[model samples]
Target chain A: MNKSLSMLENHPHIWRAREQSQQEERFSLGFDQLDEALNGGISTSGVIRIRTLTGIGELSLFKHVISKQRTHKMIAFVNPPGDIQAPWLATFGIDVKQVLIVKPSTEKESLWATEQCLKSTACHCVILWSNGVNTKESRRLQVAATHNDALCLLFTRPNRNSMHNSAALQTLPISLDLCLNYRQHALEVSVLKQRHGWPKDSIAIHNDWTPNNRAIKWAVEHNKVKRHVLHSVS
Target chain B: MLWAYLYFHQITLDTHEKASLSVGNNSRYDTKNEARHKRTGESANGQHQPGKTQTPAVIVYCEKTNHIVQRNNGALQQGIEIGHGLAQAGALCPQVCIIPFSEEDERLTLVQLAHRLYPFVSDIVIDTHNTLAIRLDNLVHYYGGHKELWSTITHELNLSKVSYHFATAWSIEAARILALNGVDNYECDRDNIKHRLSQCSLSLTALDKKTKEALTRVGIRHVHQLLAMPVHELGRRFDNNTISYLTALRGETFPHVTLFRPAEHFEHFTLLPFDVENTQHLTPFMEKLLGYLAHYLRARNLQTSTLCFQIDFREHPSTQLEIKSALPQSTVDSWLSLLTLRIENEVLPEPAVSITLRCDNFETIEGSNGDFFSNRFNEVAQKQLIGRLNAKLGEECTFQPKVSDTHQFETMSNAEISSSISASTFTSDIVPTFLFDTPKPLTQSTKVCFGPVRLHSEWWHETPRKRDYFIAQTLYGVRMLIFKDEDNQWWAQGLFS
Candidate 1:
């Protein structure tokens, strides 16, 4: 063996990449492609931001992440915009008993709830839907997440090009930010900000709805054929 | 063998003071004036009589007999006596102020005294009327000795300014007899109890009035004279009850003293020093009350799930506010935080003069030793956070999702955020995670991706219905559950991740 290869073989633990050093400490996002893109999966510390347009399948991504979390740990949704369809989440293999929904009426209360869930070791993952969060609140949430080793995912709607102010866009934290949108009936995930390591510009994931749609089309065509045969016999 | 009895000498007077003490710097006379002001809607400033100010002279009038029942030191110095007619007492002490006696006030004061002494002794028996008999055998050594224990008891009583007479003996009966008859302090030894009883008056023993009169007729003026007679003859002469009382007092027989047990619930009331017109003034008082409650809980190894506060106003009916915890809590800080959050939104309807705190739903904490590891610490912190949030926001706003067994889409799941829900009993792989509150109509151009599961109702309703359910995909690539009715119209039921 080469001299450096022999040295590396002697102490493999010390020579591994820093990102892969604590592999067990991180939770997989359930997508091997996304995991490889982010240098192993999401770290079970600090905060991750996912910016997307309204009604662009943010909830579906959240359900996928929630299903990947450990069954024993609780998953909290702080101030979600709409009613959470429990049956739909159950279909994605998420345990309903371990899910907590906090609907805070005000923006201030929503931020507080997010921070509390992040600081609590009882919860394994927190999905926060916040419209406009400032820099200070984001920092507080990041510290809390680090304290408990909890995965915090903040999903926000992209700033609309309406009359005037861009305060929400300007205040985005300089951390890992991913932009998700629909492209040709598939999800297009792109990395807009990366604090460390190399990240690919974009990736396309075929929607999981393809097989279900094909089955539905076959059923509909079969039903139409049976109806036509009955009509001809009459 | 060390036993102590506390006799509240003038419980009626103390009860009167208790009601007025919270009004701040107001004497018993001012309390009467305030009561009069409440009834007539008149201010107390003009109701005061001249020269009656600060004269220690005070009178307690009994309405049933229309006579003076009690008098203060100033009245005593002026030669006022009990059982005198109200007219005569008023004439004798012109500067004296009179207040009516209330039985309710006296009863509440005695209960408060019992609560105060419970920490020092566990086996306390409240004697007839205004006496509390405490068994201080093993407890005396805890305070150094009998003398030190007595001093400690007196110190506490003096701090509360309770007018009390103390007595101790080998038996509870002897101590009560000594304290009732103006023998201020005495510690009778077991060997010399007979000698001690010999000096006590015959009227002080627990004998009926008829038996006492019969003994008096026979010229028995003291306990020794009654003891000189033959036992059989005494029993035949005055009845078995008198003989039994004599035997119990002399330490020859054990008396059946009904031991007092404090109620299992916690109830503490205090008259505020000043009227609480706003909720902010109540913080200190609430903290003090919570501290006492925490002490009680620690001693009993119990935690409370619910607590209620009753605030009494001078003119309005008392208002009640209840606070509930997500879990049984014993720590003072957790309870204080919840209480502070609850009081922030409360608006006081009237100025509160007194407050009462009570809790009955107490649960015994599982482990006596709170040696919690990191995991248990986190669990407690999470519970505290949930409790605070529920208290600040409404209970309905926070919950965990509960899955139910049902074929209907929306009915399959509901929020089960309350602690009362049992652990998950059932799980289904077929149920979708999200179901719309109401099904939406689907457009004709929508594409079906899966499912032609035909479902028919068993005619349970007035109309039997058939439907074909299908998994469909919107143009936006959202997976949805759509169903076609018997009329061939389709509706979007739910979405799948």
Candidate 2:
């Protein structure tokens, strides 16, 4: 016997209305800057590709938003467990209760687990390590995530030579690496692509790590040594 | 336990918008009449007794459901906030609360509840993704046979405000058919099986009738009529295994059901994407995974005795490995520490692809009444230290017995070789403490920092060469790691990390 018929045959109106509403409402992260940049903070209901350079603070940005979520959200880290730095997360002020993690064995297993999580209503967000994700695999995950109204964040380490464009076609709205600066321990963020409005102007963010004594002292000493060398060269 | 599966008919705000008073604070609705008109049961002061008022309260009715699903509150379904039906319900009605019908939530709740309840039953098998089958034979007696179990289940559903339909039969197929057909209650016995089949509307396909003439020949007018035929003659007259199926459905023969699967290790975890570097991003996920693995093992009366870590680069296509313990233990701490160690020892050529901790060996563990002792058994400090090291290095750099192959180092092998222990089955076989397959040169003068240690293996092999290995330091202050070739030449390997 088909179970779906028993579940849906009697409630055509409800099922249809839910389907329609889910389609009409585009989900957002509620962060105006990031939301505007990526159509709306990663489609609340689809797989989203967010790419960044290796050294840039892309992971930090994703974590900051995910950490304080009051809503029930599950995040699956496809990246190797050690790749993410835990201490850096506390600095961003993320809460511990609202998130869940899943570590899959291989890339194939990782994708499978991710797809399973996306299909589950228990999870609100699925963040994947998209280092080797192809367009087809990415699309498959996006479809699964969207079907369940869960958001998918692809933390991509882009090719050093080529700009990553998988998200451009997969997501209705897209945000590309505009630009970021790690200057004197400070971070400045810029938007390169915006599917919504004129992208926000470049914003400067203070690096909390820089304010610590050890980091500050190290920066000061390093700068002094560089200055002395420059003077001697002149 | 008395069980009742109930669905709430209606609940809404327009009825109570005027209820401005807080639970103990001032009132929003001016008079009791306004509150009485709403479909909901209570008045602003919380003093209104149910079933005492002249008119019922308005409650939200589930628009999706039909049939006996709506036990009460039909009037609230219309725009009427205060309906007469709702006012009569008991404050804690077995059926009145608003329970969201989410498939995800239902599945999650079922799994979690099942985990907690396994000890009470002989076995419990959950069919996930709607395809996996579960056999309930052994568990039948534990729940006090079919009648007692179904009644107990019905009681639980009433408490949770959930509605479900189920049955017990000789075959899983028959049970599934009965449950899906809205036949909520059942007792699978020899005498009642035919009566149940007779009550069902069996289509031609369900009965496997070839054509209208074939169906009429047996005078099998209805599903029940066909079920009365003899099994052997029915098969001879018809095609395929239809007769066998009929017999099974009638309880003459028992059908096979899928066996329950128990996890080797369990985990329960949640993860959120924080900034890339914070390893804590994985803590919740780790915790959840461990919980699932633990619970899975417990269901099978087993425990994970050994674990291995698989760490990947987030940005690059490289993998690292780490080994945690020689012995098996089922706890979050052990899994976490092994993960940490793997993380520290390996370097991500890129950030990280993903991290996985797999516990392969499970030892039978007696069910313990209290979990408090298990929580205190593992060390948090060791796990934390391992996690730190993993964050600084990579997950793969650390090596343990299970994850790493204990193969002899050969001439072609690098300093770090994947372990072969995965394929080796010798539980007690002891090989040499160290076996180097790659023989170094007997002599080298690049800067002899340390003396040579002679090495030999596979003495039976005809082409085996006797060689000396030296740990060296170069004049440039760089450690000149050189190996002597069997031909008497020296090759220098790079400085280690």
Candidate 3:
């Protein structure tokens, strides 16, 4: 309506406080710390990097978010560390049949599989766990994900030294980067890089394995006495 | 030199009819079988019960005929002979299956017969459209004698299930004349062969109508009379071609026989003009090889699934590389994609020398069915992705995760995922995010966060195992599914990713 408002809408680099219709659809991670740290959670597409080791709260963190992606489409796991347990996927209320696993022997093949899945219209999301992805590979993955508007979450195992520090010296156009850590046997996650928001502090979720177990104190109290005793005879 | 002539009069028509009938075995083709049974004059199926009453006379339709060109014995029995018009044959026999013929199919049938007899006889000539002449002069010693060679040839022809009329004489032309004259017996003795050849009519000698009519007008209708005439005397009436034919047929002179060489896939080996360092420059050579391959595929009308090339080097052992297409393909483009993908990665150990390209199996091109009303989700693209993965990576590498109602985690993911997952109902028990391909022995000390859920193999299974499972977080905060077996050995199975 106004001259200033028209120029503001026309400007390419300007960020606007538009209506909900103009805003990208955000999927809440179902965890307050992750949603708040990710600034209204992740979208349906774009590259998100998770810098973590093999086993952490990464799967449980995005359990609810991944299920919200199109159910008719597929979710591909490229070079996953292990067999994606169907029962575990079932626990998240996602269709187990919608999961496709491509186990490429080499990192080059893993990147190819990731790009193929991202480019395919049938696949909605891709979870990649190749350690060889760098700035170029991450950018390539981002471009491939941008085609057909699919989500790609790359899980890179950070260096032993870099895992502790929030290394923000990045070189890729990554939307979000979260590093998972453990503190006193509880999972703590913090944002290493964010596209349009400030990186947030680490948040501690108190579930060790099962909910409300308080396993750190219980293991110290119970595991010490019965370390070597056998439970029952066959 | 002794020669044997094998004449397959019904090979082309029989093969054509059998091909269409066996392709689908429609009920409509049942009449063709009845015709063949009565034509072969054998009731192998016992369906020739009414004797030729309902047998359809099988005749070869001459595209638009002034004449009926070919016929089976039952057609002749019905008085619908060769040279009779279609109108005449139709009037004679109401139930007739007039099959059209082609020279290409006839040549292929002849080559197939030659292929069957190639191993037994060394010097066999594809003499004519329906006749094959085998030179027993040199091959008789190899197979012990003429009788053995003749018997082997007959045995092979019988095994091919083709109706063949064969005759042996001193020469190919004499043998052919005797064969077409119905002297289809293994007569190896020279006198008996001469007697049979002398009795053969001039009609079976492949002479033109004018020459035969002139010879017949002079009361010389048999081979004995033609052989009795002097070449110069016959030359006064007949041309030099007929004179040469008479001389050759009488065994006075030997005829040149071009021995048949079995067909092989066209192969090419090209040597580089100079030692090319980079593989990029060698595309010219690869182009030449692929061009030849395309011509070969087109010429033979064949589709091949696998192609290979042997790359020679200056010093290193020649490397053999194989390229495969996802489907049987005849075009050069389909193979070029795989070829570029294969050759781009191949690092030649030494400088180039030459390349030998080949197709091991030439598969006949088959028809493909296309879907007109497919869904909008781009299933073809999805399938192409799968096929590319199968071609580049391995087919076994891609899989869809499925859930089976089994306590043994190994067998659960292997089962194909059905549409309705009613077999799986998520329980409240703690489940790990990722299951290890194989369980490893637990060496590190870990704290169990949750308790023992007893899981074991079925009692009927071999080597049944029992274990108490727990959700354990490692010292580094990696949550895993661990178990203590009946042997009291601790093992880590998987992780909560």
Candidate 4:
């Protein structure tokens, strides 16, 4: 207490509180372990960049987050206009009207739209899907996303080697990896990184609204990927 | 060429039951019954003191209905109600078709057919509104006079089963009267127009009077009588409107007819069913749209100086970016390249569903000569590379100072990474350019520890951050987080960039 007082006296301005309080407007990510892994939840701080190999659930994760935020705020999808697989997002609760999709006529338009979404305070989240995001552009969006207090997510299908080679990459204080658990009729999610506390192990989520009996039976039969549960315990 | 006229053609079908059922109402028949009950004339006619033994005048009005003279086994003459008498027509023939006569479509068709016959005539105004205004003055000479022109028009109209009464006169109104009442279809002319008018009627009914008393009072009737009236007296009695009407009838004022031609706006676009994920897929389609837009622009001698790019995402919404240029060029290649550079670094978190290009900042190209030689090959290539770097690094990792005269550090804003950077490159002023990344929080000795920089944005508004900023070092001497407080207190913001 005396040391704290001394530090405060020297500074004359810094808070001496035990907990550094931040704004609380977090959303449930559906997966409890993923939420726990992301320090409470993905930081609504700024733009969040998610890099993945093709067909690695980047788009699915984005759809999931958008579904969660769309109830209270507007979510935008900036891409080239195309037929969105409506059935895929139905289980996650995203419908046609709630999603505002933009397909820019030009590449410049795509970037400009992303910038606009980040600046839009009314927008809860902005998702930009493109095959061509580079380091400098991602950083710029991150700054804009942070300033607006709107979540900006970038989807990139970066190879493992390219991900490692991206010099501008900084460890995301929060990250989650969603994988298709073959044995179970659900996705197995694990936290790849966390800033605060270690996230609990991989949790096997059964098919949407799957009964507990089926989930338990599947888990008992295929427990090989259940090492995440053990890691959380230790 | 003919009289200036307004013509309306209405076609009515006997669909009382069918129409009512189609509207989903079964009570329409009852409503019709109620309407008939409220109509007082038919029921009250005999009750009114038996009209004091007064006999209602047998009104002999030929109520005209459908006017098409159709051929039944090549027969030319047609009647209004062949199957039923006038009194029982509605009940006996409940579904008879009523087609109001149209002079416009007839005249238009005649003029079109005439144009083909008289190819020397550069233009023909189809007086479709009036039935009697077919011109023979110019065409007569082409066909060697009255007989040939009349035969041609008659034969053409007859082939289409269209019965027409033809007349010739110095004025269109005279021709109209002659066509309606003449014995010979083509014998009426300038000399007989006055004689025909005088013989027709001397009552106001001839001038289209609707009331019986008014028709009787206008004893000074006939078109000739009305036309021969003193201009001043006509004006004082009937107002100035009659002067203009008489003037049009006497051919004193000529009406200029405008040929119908489609107006062109010079704009076009292409649409796709799905968002273009691959630039390769979008490039060719964009080229086609731009090609059409360019052709339209060139045809109008105009150019687009600014263009906008818009993309709609599958999951969320749309995004738009505008690109402004100092020059205008019709080529789509440059635009595609520039746009590709901008989007080259952008990652869409969702698949794009659609894209659109909007062009604005239009201006006249000034001359027919087109000369464009400001090749931006190197600049475009550099921009593409920089965009890739920036997208990966974060948009903040690149900055071009948006210079302003302000003492506060935060107020010193920077322009975004775009073409605007090169515009300000010529100036020699000390423009402080900052890195795109956030400045890392620095750790130092704290006589005055990291502070909450008391930044009251404006006193009048909900002022943000009465921050007191600080820089504090760790015990191990490693530089660390910078902090700011609300009321001149401390909290970490970021690390030094």
For model 2, residues B286-389, the per-residue Cα lDDT tens digits are 45556566656655666665554444443556343434566555656666677665555443353332345566666765455344332332234334433543
User: What's the best-to-worst order under TM-score?
Assistant: 1, 3, 4, 2
lDDT of 1 by residue, B324-382 (tens): 99988887788999999999998889877778889888888776445322224355756
> Superposing all C-alpha atoms, what RMSD in Å does each candidate have to the true structure?
20.5, 29.7, 22.0, 29.0
Give the 10-residue window scoring lowest on summed lDDT in candidate 1 chain B. B37-46
Which model, 3 or 4, shows the larger TM-score? 3
Residue B109: error of model 1 in Å? 40
Q: Which candidate's TM-score is highest?
A: 1
The TM-score, computed over Cα atoms with residue i paired to residue i, of candidate 4 is: 0.30
DockQ per candidate: 0.21, 0.01, 0.31, 0.01
- Between prediction 1 and prediction 3, the one with superior DockQ is 3
Weakest 10 consecutive residues, lDDT, candidate 3 chain A? A13-22
> Which 10 successive residues of model 4 chain A have the least lDDT summed?
A174-183
Q: Which ten residues in a row have the lowest lDDT in candidate 1 chain A?
A: A14-23
Listed in order, each prediction's TM-score against the native is 0.44, 0.29, 0.43, 0.30
lDDT of 3 at B327: 79
Model 3 regions lying over 4 Å from their true place: A1-22, A162-169, A207-234, B1-378, B415-428
